[model samples]
Target: MVFSWRKRKPRNGDKKVHHMELEIPRHFICPIALDLMKDPVTISSGMTYDRESIEKWLEEGNFTCPVTNQVLTNFDQIPNHSLRKMIQDWCVENRSHGVERIPTPRIPVSSAEVSEVLFSVTDSKRRLDRCECLNSVHKIKKWGLESERNRRCIVANDAAGVLAAAFDAFASDSVEKNANVLEEILYVMNWMFPLAEAQLLLGSKPSLRCMVWFLKSNDISVKQNSINVLKELTSCDQLYGERLAAIDGVIGILFKFIKDPISPLITKASLMVIYHMVSSPNEKTKAELVEMGLVSLLLESIIESEKSYCERALGVIDKLCETKQGRESAYDNALAMPVLVKKILRVSELATEYSVLAIWKLSKYEEKVLIEALQVGAFQKLLLLIQVGCSGETKEKATELLKLLNPYRPGLECIDSQDFKNIKRSF
Candidate 1:
């Protein structure tokens, strides 16, 4: 017989708590949580615990059984339905004591089921049905959101390439007809990250076209996701970065977002894409970004940004400074030296490092910029950075900068940041 239990609410005049003081059976409690086991499951260690609790433990990279500390050889979780039913029966038997029945949990999605869903998405695309495709894509996103395990399964099943194909196919379709599907495609693709294999799939001219098309999307989410995917791809391989930089007008679109300012998230994503694109060995990529007034926008970002945004903007500037045109543009900006100097030792180690690099590169060859660096107190901060702590490369750059700026120093003695009374210039 199927049984159900519901706690009875007490009348106002009863003045008694309905369910606070009842004693739950020892076996019914989850060992992990020290509470009633709502959805009991047995693991390979021959221990039964609440499903959510055990899954959380495993998800945190634990391989040993929580109770006995035995190493788990098999991670499968078999539902203790019989025990669950018994718990329900006990609840039903104690309804007058205000025990509530445990609800039966739905079975989690299996890998085979994920494959079937992926196949359905492909089949739906072949049949040219928008509703079916959207539904299937949504299913994958749902499972991906359900748990980390499902996301791992989605990644294992090549969801990145499949989703990219779907996105490419639907990118040119009427936005009203395929907008939701495209967004879902990007959403699901996000779950399958470190997309090394998908990088090849998305590196083609057609994929670039799709990304450009998505960037034109009126929906902020579509634009955000599109840029985020590009960031991931360019990060995976510098070859991908070179390919993306080769696309005409792509750099301009990314800069437009920075110039006009979208949300902070999209703005940072766009900066990272620029960082990766210019990070390629190709100097022309960095040159193209500078040609589009990238230096001015990055300076603005640094002056008005929070710590995270400040770090990204400085990183891009540092990359750009590696090129001649980029260095020229930065030297031309009056705010350049002051802003870069101000960021030192203030934002983060990375921010300070990038700031120092930009200063070092820009002032490396120019006497006027070296003086400007000294006037902005760059010399003092560089010394402080070297003494306190920094990456070896940053320390090296700071030391070189100090040597370069020392002759320009008003006196051989340092007075701004620290005592140089006993210090000797190795240079």
Candidate 2:
């Protein structure tokens, strides 16, 4: 121990040190598991320590990194077993409470499945029976997935099957029982499936026969439903011409309905169908309409029928007058102009309004028909109507006719001077 000059370890209480010194720990001593100071608690001395900081550290886990936070990327966080048990309990409770869970079936069955189930069975009676079965099944559960499956099935399967289902539903004695089902079927036919197949199905002999049966039915609702189906069928652009041709005497049949006092709605709808049939400027169809005495029938309906029927009949005539062929066909038919003119003179004010519209349409072929109107005192009657009986539009039309009849100067003078002044004043 020869007095080696090793640096002396300083005592805690030593006062001879010249420079001040401090120490810092090389690593953080906080527990990684808690991610914060443990056992932290406010103390009387305004200092806190381990056990309290640890509890706070654990609670801090409830919060997280402000940006990254506690987020689950996979389903593991959901605890599937726990969720499944919860759902199962809920289902049990609902069932115990007698609440019915509606199953939603997708539309259209697979084509192959539809064919196998619907088409492979050859008997028409069996086909209809199968459709009824499918419809019943669909009704009970109301499965959206199954409905979609059936729709797909119909599209893929036999075209005849789809048509058969449609026809059966339409022609069923209990349409009230099947109306909703039939509507769904029509939706698939009209909007989901290819139009060509729908047209073929609609135009098929069996389908048409079913529709005809419905048309002849005693139930008014059933008859109207059939007409609506036919209307939708004919509404397709591709089927229009062929369906018109195929439904032979459709116009005649409709005309018969027009005479039926019990079927005014049917008659009106039938006329609308006829309007569409004739709307294409088809000369042959126009001639057929004329041949069937449609112009006379429409004019009579406009003049003599109740308000609803008259309005619809007027619409038919309005459509007829849209094309040159329709106009000429209407004018050349001798019964048309005279009947319309007589109606104009005879009907009430409102009826006169429609009658004047008909007259205006007829007057468009003035070069061919005006002189005949003049001979029938149509010019004088219109002049008198303008002066006293008609409204503003009728007067304007009457004035237009007078202008056209300028060659007949005597008839032109029949327009009252006072009426002209009133018309000019109104203008």
Candidate 3:
């Protein structure tokens, strides 16, 4: 029992008339299915089709009216109840033809309904009633993941700000038993990615304390969420300053994320945050990272991580080695010298610069380390690095390291990168 139109009335000023037979109308066939639309739904463009058919069309990258060539603002699909009833009646009338009725559609959570739920947070009497607020926010978060429309609804209705306030409320009081409330808030914000205001609020001191508290939470998901959000917060230029990064125990937690990251994402964030921390010429911060075994950790991690992580690790290492203590610690690590040399010309251009700089820093004052560098074929790597070609700055650093090593070894033979045809022997 499908249906379709065969003709329509002509436009005004035209006296033309058309007639068609309606013995068994073909108005029931869906354009997408060429048959009856079971579980039909109407889109924003006023088009109706089978729910699964239209969903598939949308999912396959179509985002316009299938018939009218109009663009759709959103993908909210509303169940066509009136059309379903008509199809059901037609199916009953055509029972002999084997047509069947489509099942009842489930009710969707509307934007207005979600707003009603979110608005409960503002109730003065229920202001202290956290469960109601938590439950409402949890519903909003759940609906947000259900579809794009729900996500837009959540954002448009300021669900992130409400959740941030709820989070801050619980975090401010910090009742030991109410950690679940914080965990729920963390989960929601992680999903939301929290807009500018919400992100700023979350980066505030009180909220940061709660986040760091969550890092110590027994729940692994909460810990990861806390790390991810911190990553997000520090990435913003405004939030990376004195309020959060300078907070006591922040670097320790970031180091902990590095020492024992639950996942690769944590490791990446830890590196990024630590780099950001050290980039501001904070000697105390760099020294703290070094004392926390940052040098050893990065040397190990560089091997474990892929290209981008390795590059960032080197960048941080270079920054840290500017301090004398950082250099000593790196020299103490058994893998430091070998790893630093191995990375040159092998890992990346940036890594090459870092490796050479580390060599200069470590070997400049430690002749024993210089002898070890020569024995490990460090001079060969630096010379090759300059020959194979790198950034002008990288070449200059490599050349400087080579010259420093030459005076010490005296007999180390190397060729000029710009004049490889002529062999220059250092005597």
The per-model lDDT (C-alpha) reads: 0.81, 0.52, 0.73
Estimate, for each residue in 298-388, the C-alpha lDDT of model 3 and write its tens digit. 9998875787788879888988888998988987888887788777766567777877877777877777777777766788777776776
lDDT of 2 by residue, 196-221 (tens): 55565565555555565567667777
TM-score of each: 0.80, 0.44, 0.67
Cα RMSD, model 2: 24.9
Let me know the TM-score candidate 3 reaches against the reference structure.
0.67
What does the lDDT read for residue 296 in candidate 3? 92
Number of the predicted model whose lDDT against the real structure is largest = 1
Error of 2 at 130 (Å): 3.1
**Model 3 worst lDDT window (10 residues):** 418-427
Candidate 1, residues 1-427, lDDT tens digits: the string is: 2223334556676765443466778888889888888889999999999988998999899999999999999999999999999999988888666667777776777889889988988787776677899999888888888777678878878888777766666654554467778778877787677876667766666666677678888888888888888888878788777777777788889899889987888888888888888877788878878988899778966786788888889999999999899999998889998889888877788998999999999987799988887877878888877887789999999999999999998843333443233234221
The alpha-carbon deviation from the true structure for residue 313 of candidate 2, after best TM-score superposition, in angstroms, is 1.3
Better of 1 and 2 by TM-score: 1
Model with the higher TM-score, candidate 1 or 3: 1
